[model samples]
Target: MTAELGGRIREARIARGLSLRAMAAEADISPSLLSQVETGKVQPSVSTLWAIVTCLGLSIDEVLGHSPASREPLRVEHPNPIQRARDAPEIVVENGVTWRGLAVMDPNVDAVLVTYAPGAASSPDDTHMRHPGTEYGYLIRGELTLKIDFETYLIRAGDSFCFSSSRPHLFRNDTDAVAEGVWFVAGRAGAASARSAPGPVRDAVDALDAMSRLPRRVGG
Candidate 1:
């Protein structure tokens, strides 16, 4: 339960891109409390934790990491479905590469776990799709080269990068091994903002369409 609470708080903070101090201030709690909550050092009362979760705009189940009982994450399954991996459709991109979107959301951001094969490169997305918010990525394994606005960044396992979503960027895997990473896209929050900003929407659509046209390969 303590581990669960910590995971929930940490996940919420990361998903919302909030610093501990920032979230603490928003929830009218101290940074110490937030840290404790994230580390499972000090369990927060139900009301206190609820308040924090509310400030972060996450549902209880999302925080708790609970799926339906029957569908709980399998530890030692009798017969796992390898077909699920074989059947998961890949969203093809550039250089004979493909991405299996782990998560897709139309609201404020789009995030995915991407695996890149050797010689793979990303297609350029529209700059107009770029916006005020930022994109964050963490390399889970292997090596990759990220080119953002003409600058190349080499990232490896345990490395992370955060930058504006508006940059004309591409990722390439030049190594012999496969590269796996997570991408989190920050999106607009309010309906009024969306209504007022058709430029971003157009850019995002164009960017995604362009990406879809690139060469792609699949990984499970």
Candidate 2:
């Protein structure tokens, strides 16, 4: 998955006629780091990936291989609302964060079951990510640390929270146990109820799509 993701990112960079150095500069990252990320030698943090995607003008869905061209249009009539556990698509990101799509066909929203392993965090370097949207989450198990700007809150099981994505927030699991939750992100990238999926899903799908093209590792 890492290799495949790197290849796709490299492909997108080339397709846009941007040099590695230029792209790295645009993304506020070092050229060597970008090169490592593109070659699969490094696993980029969520914030780093977000920066790259935003710089390349590529949606996350496109990265995940869930592009509009790859999926049939969702039909209002006879909609299949059931997403079986076996059929749900899941992806692992930087650190030990995992996201399983709960409503994969929804284009205007991203609803996923998220899990954070012990010590796992949304960003590797404690950086926050700010985007245009709103986030609603319900913690299902364990504990999570939510940091918004300079404020920090400890979220416990059964506790829910809502915040604007533009607040530069980050999530982390500081306990020994895994933290799980249901997360919904809406209005990302100003995406509306259109035929195409919203930005967050599209973005996540893009990352997952790259993973689908690669061979699974032992115990991955």
The candidate maximizing TM-score is: 2
**What is the C-alpha lDDT profile of model 1 across 46-112, one tens digit per residue?**
6566557556644345566755233121122224333245534356553445555432323344445
As for candidate 1, its clashing pairs are 93-214, 96-216, 96-217, 97-216, 97-217, 98-217, 108-187, 130-166
**TM value for model 2:** 0.54
Candidate 2 C-alpha error for residue 38, in Å: 34
> How many residue-pair clashes does candidate 2 contain?
13
Reference-based TM-score of each model: 0.43, 0.54
lDDT of 2 by residue, 96-200 (tens): 788876643334456679898999887666677655457899999999999987899999999999986656678888999999999887655322122243223
Instruction: Give the 10-residue window scoring lowest on summed lDDT in candidate 2.
Output: 211-220
Question: What lDDT does the true structure give each of the candidates?
Answer: 0.58, 0.68
Query: For model 1, what is the C-alpha lDDT against the true structure?
Result: 0.58
